[model samples]
Target: MNQTRYPELAGKRVWITGSSSGIGAGMAKILAQQGCKLVLHYCRNETGVQQTLQTVAELGAEVEVVWGDFADYASLENVFHQAWSAFDGLDVLINNAGIVTKSTALNDNTGAAFNRTIAINLQAPYRLSTAFAKACIDAKQPGVIINNSSIHGQQTCEWFSAYAASKAGLDAMMKVMAVEWGPKGIRVNSLAPGVVPVERTAKILAEPKMAATWTKTMPLQRFGHVDDMGWATAFLISDSAAWMTGSVLTVDGGLIARGGYPARE
Candidate 1:
């Protein structure tokens, strides 16, 4: 947690999906302050998207927003291309837009729930990373793609099979792309987050005993914060982490490190 700061990211072009709320909103605020031109993406949350753009504006960074459905890739292409045009080049892509659903197990999952969960959580990031990385490579520019995975990627909750599996798939893909794109000057990595306090997941935070149990459970003896995630992601996407790629950094409160991984085992 020795978070030193640097301004090497000033004037870079960055795109972040799922900027409407939660970790994405938090990261947008931090990255905007670091002097990056931002391309904010939202799937359906009009109010959340407005809030994110307002927050970015307050930071005084150059910002633009686009609307596209994660289930529809063609709708998203123009957003990135326009953002790339506006900024001249794209330097970073944060595939943070994902949806989580509570289905007891794959067996218990309704066909609709199962399909939607995988499409948004797993397929969205995979598709966007491919498009963004291809554009960067074709342009012969160096870039970074940070995928927002979850602690459930390595572990899992009983009813979170679809959600956890999606994240697991995302991390698995990150590993392959890191190797495939390394020589091409592109970096791809994923982050597995612990319980981060957020309005959407405030239901989880309201249960103090459960939250405490989770905290005392991790090796760090605490949960994580969105700001913590922001800093870790900022470092990974920055020049500071240039030597690292194909890495799945667990920003969990050492939850996976302490070893409760059954899903991945």
Candidate 2:
């Protein structure tokens, strides 16, 4: 509920994937306050999506909800189409749907898990961005695409090989898209957030020692909040960042700057 206004966002149409909860929901709420027409996407969490829709609606912004399975290419295509059709055009696309699974590179079954993770985290965003950009080009309208990546894309962490690889791929894709689409007035970028407490990370954040260890290493001495990511997303998509494209914005509370060092024990 930080009421910072972005006049540039007013009346814009935005599509956010995996917006039922977590960072996506946070972005929806913040964008709604900016008077943006929102197309909120959710895979299976109807309840969560409904809650998000209600929150945005209460904020008095035009909003709608849609569902799609990222693992299915056809479904993913339909998602982009439906989202774009929701407002007759999409001014921004937030590729926020992603998955992180616990897997080791040495595991024999890692290939399946890796492929699944990539399909959702990397391929889906790639396809969505491509479609959105093509549509913008056809319509002669400028657009923006923001991919929700992770600190794991650039930093190493154990048992997250598949997840890390997917995020890294996403970052690379964002850069490539920016270059290819920039001339058409389409901007593409990635936001890499670190250790935000959401339903997905609930169990990990519940561990006292683990939480303390992470908190101590961060120069900000805390994990990121959903609103932190939300506000950043809004800014990046706004006209204020018109010159920013093909860049990776890290919102990690200075965790990456610590160079993976542990707190002094």
Q: Over the full model, what C-alpha lDDT does candidate 2 score relative to the true structure?
A: 0.91
| Candidate 2, 105-222: lDDT as tens digits | 7883749989999899999998999999999999999999999999998996789989999999999889988998899999999999998998888688869999888888899988
Please list the residue runs of candidate 1 whose C-alpha ends up more than 4 Å from where it truly belongs after superposition.
1-4, 106-110, 261-265
User: Could you tell me every candidate's TM-score relative to the true structure?
Assistant: 0.90, 0.96
List pairs with backbone clashes in candidate 2.
none
Span of ten consecutive residues with least summed lDDT in model 1: 256-265
Runs of candidate 2 with Cα error greater than 4 angstroms are: 108-110
On TM-score, the leading prediction is 2
Q: Count steric clashes of candidate 1.
A: 0
Model 2 residue 204 lDDT score: 84
